[model samples]
Target: MHKEGKVVPLAAATDRGARTPLPCLPVLLLQVRDKAALQLRQGLQALFDNADDTLFEMADKAADRFDQHLYFEAMRDLRLKRKSIERGFLDIFYDTFARIGQVDPLGFMAANEPSRNKAQMERAASVEGMVARVLSRDGLALDQLSLRLQTLLECTLAPQHNPLGPAALSGYFLQAGRNLGVGLRVKLILLKLFERYVLRDIDVLYGEANQLLAAAGVLAELPPAPRRRAEDRRNDSRRISATLEPDDIGADSVGQAFFASIQGLLAPARGRIAPRLHAVATAQPIGTADLLRLLSHLQHYVPAAQEEDDFDLGQQLEQLLLRVSVRSGTRRRIATADEDMINLVGLLFDHIHADDNLPHSLRTLIVRLHIPLLKVALLDKGLFSRASHPARRLLNEIGAAAIGWETGSEGLRDSLHLRVERIIQRLLNDFTEDASLFAELLEDFLAFSQDERRRNELLEQRTRDAEEGRVRALQARQQVQQALNQRLRGRVLPQVVVQMLVQSWSQVLLLAWLKQGEGSPAWRNALATMDTLLASILPQRDPQALLQHVPGLLKALREGLASVALDSTATRDFFQQLELLHLRACAGAEGPAEVAEVLVAEDIVLAIAEESACAPLRQPDEHAAQLRAVQRLRIGAWVEVLDDDEPLRCKLVARVDSSDRLVFANRTGLKVREWTAQGLAQALRLGEVRLLDDGLLFERALESVLDGLRQQQVH
Candidate 1:
């Protein structure tokens, strides 16, 4: 049997709780003891006698202590990063060289002659040279690249020197000498450079490397290089090609082939990029110095992260995105990445996409917090959440994807740059009317919040203001259109037709007023007369036989609005004749009388009778009547695509006629059979459209437009 312990009543549980008499030490004895304890902190008995003063002195000391402690914590971070980069860079160097089989790359560098090595040495020497070639073909300037490369190499090779100056290239190698291969024995290097030079950024380093390759005579045009647009062709309106000194064909060509094979070695972090400092002697003849050069880049970049004021970076990124969007007619260079920035950006992937809701000015400041973060700005689909914000989660994304949890590699980097360029262009073109929505939201937040309150009085006032603002904006657009229509409608009939054709196109809104034949009487007469004419008719009568006069009326109004020569009397007679002819097209398939009622409502009665309108497409068999059938023609002949309602519904495509009749195709892979361009021309019923063949060679067209602009000289 388990027995429970007895519990006393709360009042009597403890002698003290029951208010038992206390047994205490003598006051004098206690005082003496307190004094001793206070002295140790500076003595208790006197301390008990003067406790307040002592406590005040100690508080000041504690505050001083914390300030110093904070400094040390910051110092600790700097040391950790310095060490991580130092170690990683050296290891990368050694591994990169060792695998390449450089027997004594370090020693080879010391010896000026062609050192004895495998066939790969000749190839390894040419690596930088070839990479330059490939990049130039993609578009890069090489003259400035050489200096950057030389700087990086010097810093790595001699870490004891002032790396920020000319000695940086050598210092880089010396810092990672062990990894450079057997024979590098440099001491006092890391300490010297750390105290000495500032390193180059990753973009400058890679950019330099690419330049070296291009200078070595390697850039080659690839088959898929976008068809060289003549307007964009490597020609200048008033400039000449710079003199180019070609490299030895035999040496450079062989080098390019070898370098291409080894390009795989540079793929880092995703696939394997062995520590460049570890360039070991092998059949491939890679050098230890070469290894040092490679890892120097890593040392220059890795472990460059630090905590930052995040708010500033977001705004800066947004501003830059806007800048990129508005720039036109020029190619912009995209940076590969800076070493530290890429990691920082990788760390903050989710943050970049997170809704920071910062003020516009502050957004730019936050973006400067991390450069890499900006790389992802506007790239993400505005999707991110609380769970994804953790640092560890972002790091995981980096490890999984070459470019921040998505596909991007060296190959992809170039493509991403191209895509970025297109997105910028598209945005500028599409967003002409609306300024950034995000920008507007931040600016209007206070008023928006006030307007949204549920209180009826405030709500009604805000709603009235908003409605007024919208009405004013719409009125402004209508005013602009009226002015534009008046100017265009008075001249250029073909252009006028394009502008005023009532259809699905953007410019159709201008057609309403123009449909009246530029006269008030014509619209009123047609409206009244047509209403009575359509009052009675059979539902199933054929539509074709009744519309003989309708097309001519539309023709006259079009000509009149354009201020072109036209027979006004004939135009009136045609519409007067069509008063009884049109059947409403919008009326249901049930037939003619309902069609006539809808026709009066459509307000097209006058246009149909006045205009000899061309429709968009025709029957396939009509090809014979439209054109004399040809036996054969070369590929690439321009032909119009066929449709039945509007010529606009028809367009141009490449065509060739063979023994079989006609063949048509477009560059985008559109192919057509059993229809011909001639058939399309005849089929157009209401929209008169025409094709201008090859439509002016690109350069000529541009020059014709731009050459007339007087160059404004700024002093």
Candidate 2:
């Protein structure tokens, strides 16, 4: 059967097979009306199943709708009905009338009046006439004046398309007229009444209903009813008209009866959400998924204008839902931090949204902070309730400062976002129970943001100072290196000794040089002394003997610095570093204790060549000495193989043969020579060769050579 524009399939039909098939439209209409009325009663009974006396009284008045004017008059007579009808049942009545081709009866009535613009003015004149008549009498009841004024305001402000019409203006005058005879207190009372009833917008009234339901933990249960198609409603109207004569059934009665029926349909469905939510919130534990579902249901009620104060109340309930809906493994009780975070978020949400004065761009930026704020709350529950907490104050300060922020300031907005993100990251990484841990950092950041010009000036100054300091340190380092190199010229030294001196003393020399002015004579003398001492130390034939000189060199370094007139503070620091280096080198040696003891006991070790008087005390077997020399060879160690001509300084590149013979490379790791350890030892015994411990100097020098070899092999 075609109901609305679409054909009603048998399965989709709301009512079917309830009675015998009928050919007559009137009989079918009677049956449908009886069924609809029965359903309506059932719906009403279910709706008021748990209702209180006040709700029952409301339901009783609401069910009486046989006569249209009488229903309105009955409602007007009841004080509670006036308030409750507007908030609760007015929408329902509008829906019923709209379904039957009437759109906003009150609006239609005012619009259809003769002289539409002057209708409210005429009404106000009539009300003023009555009020004036009452006042002229020797004794006049204040109630009469109050009632007349209220009627005038309602007529003036009653939901009209043109609220600025003459009627509304006259109503305003009538309201002010109440104070003519009454004292100031009664005037205030009349003003409050007008504001409370006449001036209140319908949206606010609906929001209040939503808020109350939310507070009672039943908002999720009462989802908005599904609207029927206009065509289907027209068909229903046609059926009602066909079934009953105009005198037999009034349109007002049908509408009132239809409202009761809707209540029944809504009752069964409304209970579903509230019971489930109550069960989860209070009865049993809920998982994240369940909580998310509940949030989904409640999200329908969260008004789009979330910046409003009442919207925050909804958010608070959402946060509470999240708090109670703990994941498994949690302690079950909500944390103090969580409560603090919820409260803080609520405050920020209200503050940002309520501030319509803020620039749109800045308001947008602040609104984006909600997610991060929520994350912080979830991670650390203590953020919710604390007023003076650092994180809490920081967020509040950001919002407060952002209010005066201008549009087009992307840099400032980005910086603020970055700072908030950084704080969030810190909270996530280090979840401290104490809120004061971030106090200093937050305070400094807040101070930095508060003063714009000073902050920029300070930042620029620091940047310039940092660059200057870097250049100064670099120049000092170069000067120290140049002085050492100049003093070491023409002095024959082992490559290993030169490299070690450079590695250990480079930083120390740079620091010492930095302490004095450029080209200072005293600093030059210190560098010259250091160079002479390093050049005098000869390469020991024994690698172990080379290790023994480290402690003595460290000691001489301290003495030389103390004797020189340099910055004492810088000198002491450099000396301490050298001492630490000595300890590390000694530890690396792993040699006999006698070697360390000898180095410690002797304040100085004189440079002794291999050909000196102490050279040949007791020579080991030639083969054994050669084996010892081969054993001491490290892959990257530098060595000198003495020929009849000039000596060759080369790095030990690789072991070519399994015996003591090895391949040697120059500083670039390119094969320069290859020979047995026995040949090198013989040269060493003859004072023509020496082993050099140059540390990683040769290894770094061979980087390019190794890369070249790798490329060649790849080809």
Candidate 3:
């Protein structure tokens, strides 16, 4: 526990190396603190209260005994210690507010930072991302609240010391859970619950705090936070700083750090391409602008898709350099920074072309944009640093749309294929010094893609729904057949009765299973009726005993047939035959010619065929590894299925649990294929199927380039 009268450290040190003491918080400020603590107590109560049931549900669904025990134990531990955890949380919250003026917020921040263990860093990054999302989503209310709090405190309070910010709430939660006995996964689960149940609606927390402080005569009419450049703001949001180490330059500024990373990656390649002609007499270095001008001139001359291989940027630059030397009697070389941009852009484009995730047509189009993209990078280094740069985003968007694209017979006429081609052409013909063209083209492409996406999503949803319905019906039919076989497989029954149960009663069972689910009253009643009808038709020790059930059995049969909407003539005929059989059983005489058989060969074979349509073709023992690989694939993953030599791209849209069938759809959401788990495994083993990576294009390229460079160094 914190001491009652301890002072919080100052954010800034005094000249004498002593900290400057802050004034006591105003009474109104103290009131605001109490009010926030009360609201927070309620939110925390909701978080922990819901956590118990969430943990219990997880325990019920646990895959194994150990996971089950872990969840159960966590639930019990949380239940017993929950009240104390809340108390501890509130105590820390109150203590933080009490010392809000005396303590240095940055010191608290540093102290709270998790150590560099990979798991800890990941968890911290997750929480940090949550905080960022909250800030972005609720910036206005938070700003007003911050102003009011600062006004009440008579000083600028750091965000970490705001008492009700996500950072503070997250900090309190982490500390409270620090002593819990749960594993990392459970802790993460609880953290997600905290975010969902608490932070999900945290705007209310800020609004309440702001109102209370404002009512107490704090700043009530605060202006909005000053706006920054939209590009800068976008870049800020895309920063990869959450995973940065404390000492990394990225912790300060993302752009510079990203630049440093690129430089490091490109270190080995620098000056290696079209080496500087320092030995030439009167060799002069060109300005970046002049180099960009040379590139722009070549950008217009980008070869067609057929001739891309023959067009080499390095050789062309060399030829241009030689021409400059002959014409002006002076050799010109690109500056170091300009040369670095040239090499980096070249590497990135090379990676893009080689990325198997993208289609050949799209890759060629993207490669054609290389010169224009390089110009953007040369003009605004943000293209290399910021993932959201318009030029970069345009490429990524194209890559995203092209993930499931195929080179069908439609060739260039495919709408999406055509749209992408048009976009690339526009960039080639229109883009010059105006980088805004990237943004403009990006906007237009996004609009066009959005329209296509909406239509595809609708089709995709319909496809998924249809596939799910088919699976459900298949499962229900199989179940009904199993039920019939269980009761009638070995018994000799009258042919007409057997036909009634097989053809009519089976429909009733399927309807029950589909509409009401297995084990439901409707399903159980249907099964019970079938059993009664079958027993009534067989010989009995006391024929009169069977007579008593005849009326009830007939009523039930009619009801079951009605539920399935069976044909009236068929129903009437089946009932008449059933009645005659009952009468014969009562007279202790043989019924109409029995089928003299049990299982219907045709029906059983049909069921098997229907089921085998989704059944795996591979033997478990022979292809266990491939089967495991197929099982690991999840829905929403894209894959390529090759027929002959042609590639068909589709996504795994749904998995039918009943048959282990995976349903795949093309980009427009039309069902393209279905496979049983074993069948897919066999296909994968035969190299007829391949998984496609659907990650962001630029990011993937960047990672690939870096990995290749790193490996090159190692070798």
Cα-based lDDT for every prediction: 0.29, 0.40, 0.73
Q: What is the TM-score of candidate 2?
A: 0.18
lDDT winner between 1 and 3, please give it: 3
lDDT score, candidate 3, position 325: 69
The TM-score values for the models, in the order shown, are: 0.15, 0.18, 0.62
Using lDDT as the yardstick, the better of models 2 and 3 is 3
TM-score of 3: 0.62
* Per-residue lDDT of model 1, residues 1-715, tens digit only: 1111223333222222123332232222222222221212211111122222222222223357654444344334334443344444334332322222223223333354556465334423432232333344322322233332233222232211212121222333344433322110111222222211212112233343444334443231212222233333223211111111122111123223432342332224221112221132221322333322332322222221223433333233334333433453322221222222232233343333331221122222222323222222212211121112111122222221111111223432543233333333333233222223222322233223223222322333343333333334344335334444433333322222222332211122223224333245643443332222232222325555435433554554444333432355643544443333334332335324411111112222111222112232334444443344222323333433224231111112223222122333322223332234554434322223223233212222223322322121111
How do the candidates rank by TM-score, highest first? 3, 2, 1
Worst 10 residues of 3 by lDDT: 10-19
Task: Give the candidate number with the greatest lDDT.
Answer: 3
lDDT of 3 by residue, 1-715 (tens): 1112223232112212122344444555555665566567666775775576456545655789999999999989899889778887776666666677454322433554655566677667778877887798777788788777666555788777776778878888887777888887887777776766567657656766767666555675665443445465344433422222122221214444566666766777766655656455567878878777788788778887756357889878877877876788777876667777788888899999998888887888778888988888777765655555678888988999999988777877898878877888787787778877877788688768866876787688777777777778887888898888788776666788787787778888888998889989999999999898878877788987787888888888888889888898888877777777777676665655443334444443123223324323444335888888778888778989875568889998888876667888888888888887887888888888888899889889988877888888888
Model 1 CA deviation exceeding 4 Å by range: 1-634, 637-660, 672-689, 692-700, 703-715
User: What is the Cα root-mean-square deviation between model 1 and the actual structure?
Assistant: 38.1
Number of clashing residue pairs, candidate 3: 5
For model 1, give the 10-residue run with minimal summed lDDT.
237-246
